[model samples]
Target chain A: MVRSYIPAEFIVEVDHEKCRRCKRCLLNCSFGALEFKDRVTPLHEQCVACHRCLTFCPEGAISVEANPLGFKYSHNWSPQLRKNIWKQAETGGVLLTGMGNELPYPIIWDCLVLDACQVTNPSIDPLREPMELKTFLGSKPDFLEFDTGADGTLRLKTKMPPQIAIETPIIFAPMSYGALSFNAHKAMAIAAAEFGTVLETGEGGLHRDLYPYKDHIIVQCASGRFGVHAEYLNAGVGVEIKIGQGAKPGIGGHLPGEKIGEEISKTRMIPRGTDALSPAPHHDIYSIEDLRQLIYAIKEAIDYKPVSVKIAAVHNVAAIASGIVRAGADILYLDGFRGGTGASPTIIRDHVGIPIELALAAVDDRLRQEGIRNQASIIAAGSIRSSADVAKAIALGADAVAIGTGALIAMGCRVCQKCYTGNCAWGIATQRPELTRRLDPEVAAQRLVNLLHAWSSELKEILGSLGVNAIESLRGSRERLRGIGLDALTLDIMGIKPAGR
Target chain B: MKNGRAKINASGIYYRELNRMIREAIAAGEQEIELIGVNGQRYIADGIKQKVMIIIDGVPGNDLSAFMDGPTVIVNANAQDGVGNTMNDGKVIIHGDAGDVIGYGMRGGKVFIKGNVGYRVGIHMKSYKDQVPVIIVGGKAVDFFGEYMAGGILILLGLTCPNNQSIVGNYLGTGMHGGQIFVRGKVEKHQLGAEVGIQEIGPQDHKLIEPLLREYCEDFNLDYNESMSRPFIKLVPVSHRPYGRLYAY
Candidate 1:
């Protein structure tokens, strides 16, 4: 029996009169849902309705219509049944998605609500209240002292190392050159420079075009060690040695030779159309001593750029983080399991590492116990959604936060999860010329700035109600956080007291 | 060689000297020049235009012929990784073993390595009409040989390795849907993708190897007759059935 198919979310529609039959819509559609039948374009039932084609149509022919009424199903099992149908229509396997907050698992954002200013305490106006958003992102000193030089000039002698000052604590994470378009990378870099923060160039070497903003960039050195030269190492504000990524923790990435175009090849310093293979293990690094060698090698190469080591939140991550801190690293970036990726194997992304919340708490507790919490600053990534998560991460001992998926969403990503295909409909993930032109660097940078501004305002509101003015005062202050409806083990793991205690 | 008389003392002085000499020669429309530098400095003769000859004395740094259009760089010593990355047209003759990613993503060029090469040699190489890239590795390669190769010719001539030794490593030609890989030695226990077809080298394959062998012999001082006497194995992608029945219903 043939079943009649009906779509619930018809977020995209096309006007036949306005379509010039130029096939621009077909090229923009990553899902291949649009096709020309007998010279008339038709939208298939398999459309995710991302609205990318509608926005790119030059003739302004596309319009979206909501599903008609009386189409709703009474059975509770209907959503799952419809999802199965959609999955079968697409890959005939399981439906794959990219860059969205996971839904099935309980989202921590929804469980925790921000406390607002009440009548008892003066609720200052958001515009008038002096809120501090300045965040420092480097190692701190243990003791403070003063010394007098021979010239009798009073000089403060302390081991307090310098930190990166951000007007807002939010930063754009490194997504790499091959994963996203150059326009997208430029947008993030420009936005970070404007916002008084830093942007990360993930593993891919710093492109020559981005050299002008070297002071605001954080260059990464990963396992493949692509595009790493003396000039590139010294060009950035900090150097990040990527031990593992949140998307696929142990697995390495392979950028197929077809995607290695001239620009990407030059930026990565590899051959064009050659598979950019990031090896699983760093050949020079076998132990912590070996890791120290690489760290000092880069430091010696670049003359004291703040060196950071980023690792996925795996088993025994606390112990590993301690080793990394003692290995002469200035910072530690911990990525959780639910992080997004441009391309990762289906098996690895689903089941690999621990949650960021638990990992952050454990690492903080371990560092505090070792009396070395001040040796390295902590930056938490992987599924940071709203301003509350940022505040919560700070309370859990994070000096700052890095956002990848959230930043992409602010730049107009629907999270269709087809990033591995390198045909991103929103012009955020692909290297295709026509699709990449859709994302304007200036406009996208504004959207990022706008998102950060809104989040910063929200962060101030939450901090004022908690009776704190600065973010530094809330570092590892778990007394302000209380868990709701959490079990004993979960409460212990999160290191938070239950509500109404 | 007028620029050779100028003494360069700095560490990264080779690239500046090479660029200045090449740019001056090209601006005057001179086609032939010689670079005499034996230092292990980086990025020598990078981004040179088509129709020029650069003879190198000492070892060069990583990315020797990066973004080279149509110039020939003849190296007297061993070179580094990313030898001919994104090179549109040129020839790089190395009289010694080259580093990793040799002929990486090279669309139109000929790289003749007189000795063995490192891992991932000829990775992602392709060819267009009248723009074929040829990478002839004179000795054994390490691993992942021709990985994700889409097009072009990758010839592995096991001239330097001991007898009865395997010329390539595990996962040879992984994800290869196009191009041809010819190995002169026995390929034992190597995993080939389903899209590739392996067979014994035929008479036509010998004809193609003859000219390349002659070029290798002249460049690296080897006997062409001694190199070609051994049996050769040829690898070609199964064009008719690229992927397999797995993707087909």
Candidate 2:
């Protein structure tokens, strides 16, 4: 099928007088979009318009010219496509995407809509009403009892260790240090602390600047086991072992050596200029039993701090999650296939794992059925676009929701899909000093905070309409969900009945 | 004197009593402890640093030796997953079956299992000269047996259950650059990586096995002579160079 050729969105022009022909731009471009014709570089029509050539030109000869008159569309699409075109125009860089399948596949978030409050139940205004978003992430005691010591003073016998408290259920998902810029991580940390939530330092070790936000941070220990030590383990309120990521299921992470700066090198405890590779599997763990050993080891090391196990939502994710909970994890962080990544193979990102919505529903149902739902708290992350997705996730079985790509979007990421190149224009995904400076942590943090506040308000509104005052009440409450335009098989898998049935 | 004995009386629930008991044991400075009355309590010896000996009579829960250091955990019954995870220095000996990731990211110490182990036994077991870790499996293991093994020694005796003939799953040594693996069977359908070299276990090989076999038999009470009678195969890296033939440059 030969489609009509469309003109490039961005055309590169080289200044003849300033052209040095060092060929540095050609060497750096992973994508073969640049070619040398008579020792002068020419941009090919296949360019995705990442603008790396323009930015890296030391001679200051290259300039990008956008076509004022956009290419004519052969097939007329919906209003969403038009909006996307305008969005692409606003940001000259190719759409930088995080999180899963955005193609017009059926979104379960839209299928499960939130009901607005009516006259029967007064809708409390968020401005005046006190909406509770506090969440506790840890095991809860079945019953409370008092034990009398020899001294006759009463002490709680069945008290559980205190859980890390969050003023909001929303949290920043773990995006590795190499995947996003240091400034981006700072933004997330500052914003999370300000919002009384928590931000995760992905598999990457916590930066020195982020040490102050220790109370609001969750450090992750992954398969590579990078930068993990007594201090790193004890630095955060909670520690998470990253079993897998949503964007690339069954695959480990590889941070190209070029991205490893001095600070990143120090923080991660890896040699400078070495490709930081996370092995596909953690060597110590061979089964569910081994997972338990690691869980306990971390627990003991940190004096019983909350330990979370993060896994991608695969075909048997429910069963795997059940095993993880049985393995003694305090929290289960499920990343749906559509989750975003700083750098993942295109094949893995597009073709691995199930949707977050389905995985969450199935896992919740499985856990509840097995009577182990209370063993661990579930935090769902993938492509949670709006507040509606958050509400749906909680209703489907998640105790809370985590935002990654959405948070990046809030922090001026245009989803240019050039993160793999390490020349991010928005300064969110690159390590280059000049590029990274574009994203100011202060401004970025404020934007993130604003986005989270809006989502929190929307979540409260949804809970209010469902006759649930607290976010906790909405967790695992499948009664509020109904399938729409989905097949019988999908509906069954999701453990929900079709709408109007 | 029997001190630091933590008793758990549940199958799946991780009660506060168990946590308190473990905490008290640590606080009391008891180096060696025995956890009795355990029937699959999750996170049994989680993150314990004290040089302790935890002898579990019944089944222990998940994450048995997470971040464990300088201790010997002996599980009498079948154990759950994530054993010896990120363990710097320690030894975990399972009398019965062991779950997945038997020695995941184990920087130091050794893990010995008397019976069969689950998948990815030595997934990322790296060695730093004097800190080389080892995992000796008495019985067969599941697939992806030694995926991404950078260092350490993984010994799998083809002693499968009476009903099965296979010792390990397919892709036995994928992405393995360093480390030595000793398997007993012919490894017929298994695929090995380019960086691996396979050879029949000769007289010289038996010298290496003598000490490991003696230790395995001593720990699990097996007949060393009977175990050594079976045919064995040795797996070594193709070259001493760790980063051999990965890139064009």
Candidate 3:
């Protein structure tokens, strides 16, 4: 150690008077922030403030807070920036972090507000009247043709492509099994099965146990093609070609060998303790035509299973989405900058990619303008916090929205941003058996189900208030939305009117 | 050889129906199946977990035997891109040259290409337990051969090429963290990737290549001794975890 200059970000404290000496806090602290030295002692430097010790402490005798050793206040040279500089100076390496970006970027969802029915139009009550939240994700024909039979009965003339039906428009975003614990993956799978929605098997291959919930799963084929076998392609209802991720765009993924344990090795179909690297670009896909080839190849492999192309919400997202739809993608998944990740360079996570709201609006507008809106359904994902965000996403031309961090939070993830260390206290992002066992799959599944149920009800309430009986009525209905604090240019890009107008 | 084999004419037939026919034929207890006129048909024997053998008369399109666990596919003509992609266990014997990105992320299988191959072949090829993937090319290979390879073996034999022409292209084995590559001819340092280290083949390496070359020679109907006459050089990863130290916790 060459004299580390980095200061402790958090300080931990133990209440001696209230401490029962049970020592559960010491066991619960996965980051090694607590130890028994005659009494419960705190290693403030090691503390990540995950609140695991505080939550598990029987007597509620532990507390954690941001370190009060304040630096000279300057907006340009903030404490975090100085700290990051110090860490880099000592390590001479790129700073890595977990979870979503912590930067205070503008959250577009907050500036946009939904319109409710006034006295002129009567609002429907969801309790009395049916509000349809059933969402189908896939390509749809622009028009339907009916043929008259000899018996004078009408039959369908056009052939229908494959579509995936979900009970609600909310889906669980792609979270790899290797990045997250097996129990966490299981919880999502169970919840998706129970909730009648879908969860994506990220770049990590699907485990044998998750085969039972294959119907509700969307297997992803990334640049690495880790666990993507023919059976894995056909295992899920849909196959998602992961072009780019929101957290770290224009980069590849490397699941460190330390995380590649026995089960993950088997699941990923690679040797244990070997780094699994996903190249930045698919080796075969160098152009739009190459992308088309891959999409068609997967379609040929799975036979009619809907294919989704997922890309980060970047500056040319609308045009990229147009090409993807033209390349025969049944669904388009746009992940925005605030999206969560297992591990990424802190700079990339905080700086790369655009907001999902703008990307969704632009893509939807472009597709509709090109008369190809029905060619592929859109799924907007990033920081979808609540049902209001979901409703807003639908109104802005998204057929559905996916939640990654929200789902983890439901399973007791405090977003401590230490998943890169593989010592997650919540048993969500770690592979350590002891830490992972802390999360009970059944309980976590129920909690996730409850969250989805609550959000679905709230979405129904929003639909009833909007005087729309079906959620489909809100799809691309920009008139139902208004910008409160957004500028004129932003409003024009989003295709929404100002608050007063 | 045609006896006890089920034949399907794939002319003007879509890839889906051709593959479906192959699957149906296999399901109906047809051990040996022959596909004629396989012009640009893709995903043959894809994800098929069987022990049957399929013979292709014409050129097959991309992703032949992709994710195939056990079946053996014999292509009489040149094979297009993505041959044996992410395949777990199987054998793809191409009588002619194959296209790019063949044996990508291939876990276990033997792919013998009689002629040359395109760029990025055997990229990200990995292995686990008893599953060690091997790609043997009798002719030259294009750029980025075995890029990002985690495990497995890639053998390049430029037997038919002129001495003036380079056997392998530039950026060879770039970003390779695992696995080994053996070239039967001389390769300049400029052709090698920064992550790759070249050395003379050892006895163990020779032992491994000998059997694989013998099999390749048998498949293409060439003399095994003639294929092994040239002195070989081996390329291995400089580091098992190439980007391990690039980040700070």
Q: DockQ scores for all the models shown?
A: 0.06, 0.20, 0.69
lDDT by residue for model 1 (A1-501), tens: 555354544445677777788877777777666777754354555466677777778998876555443436757656545655654675454333455334366555455433444676665454676878898787777777999999999898875675667888888887998889988999998999888889989987788999999878889987665666456766788889998888788867666566678888788765566566665655435689767756754654454558999999999999999999999888899998888888776556777788888899899999999999988999999899899999988887888889999999999997767776677777898898877898999999999999998899988887887777877767788876877777788779778887776
Chain A TM-scores for all candidates read 0.87, 0.81, 0.99
CA lDDT of every candidate: 0.75, 0.77, 0.92
Q: Across residues A122-234, which tens digit of lDDT does each residue of candidate 2 receive?
A: 66655566667899988666568999999999999886865888887889999878788999999999999899999999998888888899999999998888666656788
Interface RMSD of 2: 8.8
Candidate ranking under DockQ, highest first, comes to 3, 2, 1
Candidate 1 vs candidate 2: the lDDT winner is 2
lDDT of 2 at A61: 84
Query: Compared with the true structure, what per-residue lDDT tens digits does model 2 show for residues B78-166?
Result: 88776776666778889888888667666677888888888878876666547677889988898777766666788888565442376
Best by DockQ: 3
lDDT of the structure predicted as candidate 2: 0.77
DockQ score of candidate 3? Answer: 0.69
Q: What range of 10 consecutive residues in model 2 chain B has the weakest lDDT sum?
A: B240-249
| Candidate 2 residue-wise lDDT at A264 | 84
What is the fnat of candidate 1? 0.00
Lowest lDDT 10-residue stretch of candidate 3 chain A: A1-10
Error of 3 at A480 (Å): 0.6
lDDT of 3 by residue, A1-501 (tens): 476787888989889999999988988899988888899888788999899999988898888989999788898999999989888888889999999989998899999999999999989999999889999999999999999999999999999888999999999999899999999999999999999999999999899999989889999999998888888898899999999989998888989989999999989988788888999998878877888878977887787789999999999999999999999999999999998899999999999999999999999999999999999999999889999999999999999999999999999999999998999999999999999999999999999999999999999999999999999999999999999989999999999999999
